[model samples]
Target: MSTPTGFMEYQRELPADRDPLERIKDWQEFHKHFSDEQLKTQGARCMDCGTPYCHTGIELAGSVSGCPVNNLIPEWNNLIYRGLWREALDRLHKTNNFPEFTGRVCPAPCEGSCTVGLIGDAVTIKTIEQAIIDRGFDEGWVVPQPPKVRTGKRVAVVGSGPAGMATAAQLNKAGHTVTVYERADRIGGLLTYGIPTMKLEKHVVQRRVDLMEAEGIEFVTNTEIGKDITANELVENFDAVVLCGGSTRARDVQMEGRDLNGVHMAMDYLNGTIKSYLDSNLEDGNYISAKDKNVIVIGGGDTGSDCVATALRHGCKSVTQFGTHAKAPLERDSINNPWPQFPNVYTLDYAHEEAKALFGEDPRAFSVLTKKFVGDGNGNLKELHTVQIERTVDETGRKIYSEIPGTEKVWPADLVFIAVGFEGPETPIIEQLGLAQDKRSNVKARYGKYVTSVDKVFAAGDMRRGQSLVVWAINEGREAAREVDKYLMGASMLP
Candidate 1:
């Protein structure tokens, strides 16, 4: 409680983003910074409730309700309000190993469960969070602090994403030798490539990686387990193994003309664009180009939105995103989507904002299903055939989508990117390690205890829990490290 009436005294505010039209011309991050006074004002909006749900980190109604990393929200908020940014940064790092990444990419369930939001708007927790970490970096407060001592034990983390990075960081803190292996040419699996640069610049990721490296964590890139090196070899070489390889098999739309030249997976397009952009600033001409082409992105998730943004940067003539679900309400539906759960409300995300700025309308088309790809004479995608759908509940309370009559339509599409989400972890490593899998094909490791059927083997992150947010991945990674520490030593001190 910085002030008794602080929450009422201040209205919620966030830093304005760069103009969508102007930002679309370059790949730089679009978010601007707020002044210190503005950030302190935003920080004061925290209510600091007696029973604050902001840090509960629990799942409600099948979605996360609060901060998954169990961030000490109120403590940091008060510190910021008192003009103690150094203290605020320290408190923020107590739970989250990588606030910079989450601050930029996370959806901020913490805001949704804020006590202030129940009455009015939530505190700008995300904005303040980013500000704290950014200031920490600017002031040179963040630095590599390697473990003071070394244990005889060694641990190998498979994957260099958030989960794997967190696991390595914690285990190293416990005095164990840590080695992280990334199959990609670069470190930071999803963060390095899967995410677009406008949301999170690659340099930010590299900066953290450099610090981790300086802290004595060895990162091996361009090498994969179960392929370049045998999984058995990894199990034999390391005292303990933690699998954090994310669910990477992108789901495909099994429709007619699927093999057409212009039909591609969303990840493929995104990955290629990023790789080329980073490699030569897009001068290599190695990625799929949308210039002078009409693009249609299927599946309306973050990946789909990313595809839309990437297309816009490539100078696409037009773009449209397809979603099977109905458009969300302008506000939360109190009856079906009560407070404390993530609000299913409508707002223009960055990609949609950019699309609208250029195309004069939002690119998303809700409650639409793609029938098939219509190709040109030479096996190139020319157009997409789709129909409007209506949702209904069946006798057994199962939701079903039925096509509407006389609503069939075709739209020109020079390229089609499928962003329907992922299936599970690719089978090579799972099969090679002989790890048991859940019904969903994810690694069969319990949430809190990340033990696998194979002795001394563990799993976490999207590989264990299926596709999820970055915050959840960090949560699992930290928890898995604690369990691994307990297994290695008689007791564990990791929190």
Candidate 2:
């Protein structure tokens, strides 16, 4: 620990967000940073317990409890508190390959399992992490370190998401020539298109890609494997192949009148928005427009929240989000739900806060289902038919729902966004490669081993485990690289 009286003397604090109303005007990030001294004081709040669950990185109660990448939380916290920022960044890079990405967008499971959180508030672990990495970049300490030796082994990593990037970076460090192939116009996969710009900037993603490229990892964007480059060609040419193609199949809602012009997948809308932002300032008119229209987003996950924020920036007249399940509890029930696991409770995100400030109410409705979408004669979406639902626990302890009688209602909506969830990775590559698949349609691969049925062909991240957090993807990436290295050279020096 940095100080003997740290936890007792100081309280937990985080950087304040910019005013919601002003922030909603543009797509810039909302956080107003704190001074280095304030961040050090915040870092001092860490208890640094003997078994610090903050970095356990495991699922305790059906949800993530701590850092999945297993970031050295307490060690870095103490380092920051002691004013050893460069050293703190070094420790951070030991586990997570990309602190900048996690610091900006990760949900920060570390705070949920913080020992200090057992009673009082948790340490500002996420803020401290962001501060440390951002400072490293600002001070010009972070640089490209290419491996001095070459093993003459060439590896091909398909899908340049978190997993592929991590695997490629690690393999290259182990003196292997690694090449990452991306299908999109730019690298970073969802980091480039799927995510809204306000949350994670595109340049940040490009900067990391550029750094990795400088470190001798070849990034071939717009050159998709199994399409432009054949899968068999890769397997025949490279020493080994790793499939990190993320889960891209969006879970859709099937209802009456599902086909409509204004209705779109959340990723479709988000991807188009980012592409338009990057291609030009929406000048091409190729993107979906919610301007001066009522927008209704289905599903209440982070993607749904992102849709709400994106619509708000597009000058939507009104926005509302729907969830099939009932509202979550305001406070965690300590008796039934204990600590060391992420709490299941109500929390307002950035978009919801802005919606409340602008619309005079929270734009979320729970225990409701959209029965059908009513459209105009021109195939344009116009209204939504919905009904309230009641939730009850089944004998097997599952929360099931049924429509409530005499509670049907109709609401006007000009645009509809489906943000339900994802099913699994797309099947073209898996099918072409003849890789075995799980019942859930995910690529069949062992967790630690990450080897597919086909020899020398491995998989990781969403491709192997289905849709998950970025931190989890990075973890899968590193672990997968270790396994791949061992397969390649009969041993691996990677963690």
Candidate 3:
């Protein structure tokens, strides 16, 4: 341990976010990192618990507890405490192929299950992880290490998202010729399009993709299977195929005015915004502008919050987020979601902070469901009809929502964004491959096995696991690549 007094002696501290108003004016990262000395102290705060539940990454009652990739947390923390950043980054990259992405975006479960958090604040693990990778980039320690020898095996990775990127990188490092196919105009799938430039700048993703390209991994954009290219051709040409298509089918609100001109799915709005921003500096009349409009974003998840932030950037008049469930408590509620596990507590992201600053109040409305949407005569959405409901467990042990009879109300809204969630991967590619799908409509694959019903075909990421965070997608991709490499070579050394 770095500190002689151990974990309780030191305290938890993180970098502050930029001014909310200033950050809302542009699409750029608002978070600032801690200084080197501060990071070292934060690292010293880790107790290096005997059990080290942070890296266990296990499911204890239907929920994941720690880092899914089983990162060597304590070892890296100690390394950082000693200012051994290069070594810490080495350990980090050993388990995670893309720490730069995860370090920035991941909802760090490792910190949630932290032993220190039970009594005191959790260790600043996420900040340290980001610092290590940033140092690696700054010190020129992170370079592409191409395999000295080629195995002559060819692999096709469909979808250039995190899953396909990780799989291709690992497979290429294992001496296989890997080619990633992306249907979009660019590689990096959601990283390039779905995610806004504010939270995760697109250049960061491009830099990593460039490095992967230098390592001899081929990226082919604007080429889709079963349409532009055939799945049969892929199976016949390549030794193996890994499907990484994400869950893109947006869960929409089924209401009367959903067909109105101003109503749109969250993905379409965000994707269009990112695409237009990337296409040319968000030119006038660029795709999906929300200028001077009253925007009502339905749903309470990250996507809904993103819509709020994006609308603010576009200078929307107002923003509101609707949630079916009641507001979460600020502190941990063990009976609902126990400790040493992901706490379902209230935490505000960048978007919500901006909304609070500009709108003079939080934009969240809980326990309210949109019954129908109101639209103007010109086919543009105008408002929303909603009602509050009480959540209770009904007979047969199922959660039921009961509407309050007199709670119906209407709110003004010019643009309505449906940001509920995703159902599953788009069916075109799945149907093209004729892959077996689970009841949830995800590509069928055993959790650890990752092997599909068909031979020489593997599935991973959102396509296999359904909608999840980028970190989980990367882990699934890496693990799936290992399984695919083993299947092809009958015993591989690449990790």
Candidate closest to the true structure, highest TM-score: 1
lDDT by residue for model 1 (348-414), tens: 9999999998989999999999998988889988898999999999999899999999999999999
Model 1, global lDDT: 0.94
Encode model 3's per-residue lDDT on 1-495: one tens digit a residue: 778665767778889999999998888988988998898899998887889888888877666788988888888999998989889999999998888887888889999899888987888988899889989999999998889999999999999999999999999999999999998998898888877777788888998999999999999989988799888788889999999988888887776877988888988899988888888878845678788999988898888888999999999998899989898899998787877878888877788889999988888899998999877888888888999999899788788999999999999998888999999988876787788999999999997678988888899999998898888888899989999999999997866
Q: Write the per-residue lDDT of candidate 2 for residues 312-343, one digit (tens) a residue.
A: 98899999999997788988779766898797
Cα deviation of 264, candidate 3, in Å: 0.2
Of the pair 1 and 3, which is ahead by TM-score?
Answer: 1
The candidate, 1 or 3, that scores higher on lDDT is 1
Report each candidate's C-alpha RMSD, comma-separated, in the order given: 0.7, 1.1, 1.2
Model 2, position 214: C-alpha lDDT score: 94
Question: Arrange candidates by TM-score, highest first: which order?
Answer: 1, 2, 3
Question: What TM-score would every model get versus the actual structure?
Answer: 0.99, 0.98, 0.98
Quick one: how many clashes does candidate 3 have? 0
